[model samples]
Target: MASESSPSDPAAWLALLDWRRQISALYARVRELRDSDPPAAHALWQAERNRLFRAHSQSPLLPEARADFVSLPCWPYDPALAFSAPVEFLPLERLDIPSSTGQAMPLVRFGRVELPVGTLDVYWIDVYGGGVFLPFRDAGSGHESYGGGRYLLDTAKSADLGSAPGGALVLDFNFAFHPSCFYDPRWSCPLAPPRNVLDVAVRAGERAS
Candidate 1:
């Protein structure tokens, strides 16, 4: 079963709602500017994300860390690392991926996207209100990025970039971000499985701080 915030902490739930709203709004603007002005879009994303992490009530940063938080460390945006790829549908297979908080996430492997870097499995969250969930690990993992992985798209939380004219998903490494668990262990986050590990070092997104 999915977890819910404690009823006693209604303020916490409200903050969470605010955080999701801000994220959705930010991505909507990003999708509008990404095709025409990628650099500007990238700057907007980083600036807004830093703002949230530093002061937003739902920020994943620990209380002590937030006090000293300056900005999230990110690599310079590389236009070449972005692509629009078609999803190759596969026979759905149920899988339970282990999480940082030790909760297993039930997902359905439904498709794959072939990119210049490598192919990555695309999954559906499988539970009610299922959404696209694409997490990946690259050569830079554990060195340049988080050890577990980074998420490219987690539509459940509205982290989607608009699709291309052909309906291909816009996979932009520049917007890739580490999961909340990377900042605080209290968050439960599903990681990339072996099939989603890329051989190339996708040096174009949020980096290890």
Candidate 2:
């Protein structure tokens, strides 16, 4: 352990994140203008994309302890997969959640597959009542995939997910990985949407594969 003494104080950690986020926010701005100005936006666009690559890859963002994946029921709910395999994200348009107010993200299938199991990334991101927020299920729910569809990426709070690109970026299942809940059940997780469920087994990414 690096001694809780080093600038590991909560405030320091927050400050570092805040600084990094300012950079991330700048990238979001560039992406918003891609339609109007392709060339100019592309530069800032690439810069921002690189930053995100580093946020999860370069920077020591998640602590080793928190980053460690544990089977559900033993630890607090941590919804992120520590992926050893690498896959590029396939972008898709934002689809709305069937019954609720949420965005649908398309994810392209990876690895060796049998049929055309399309990849569309979608996220139903909200809940009734205060203090309640989560993602939902769809056609691909349960089965070969996670019984509780993969959790969306969160930047706000661990549970609070962020908005998708203007239909620009959506991560694939090879990268879909697992949520913090898979490691520890003490932590709650979002249930996949009924519409999201699918019959064919999605043999890729994180499951028994």
Question: How close is each model in CA RMSD to the real structure?
Answer: 1.7, 13.6
Candidate 2 local Cα displacement, residue 42, angstroms? 23
Top candidate when judged by lDDT against the true structure: 1
Across 171-208, the per-residue lDDT of candidate 2 in tens digits comes to 22332334444434433444454544445544433442
- Checking candidate 1 for backbone clashes, the offending pairs are none
Local error of candidate 1 at 111, Å?
0.7
Q: Which stretches of candidate 2 lie over 4 Å from their true place?
A: 1-121, 127-145, 152-167
User: What overall lDDT, based on C-alpha atoms, would model 1 receive against the true structure?
Assistant: 0.90
Candidate 2 versus truth, CA RMSD in Å, comes to: 13.6
Q: Using alpha carbons, what is the TM-score of model 1?
A: 0.96
What lDDT does the true structure give each of the candidates? 0.90, 0.37
Total backbone clashes of candidate 2, pairs 3 or more residues apart or in separate chains:
37
Q: Which has the greatest TM-score? A: 1
Cand. 2 Cα-lDDT: 0.37
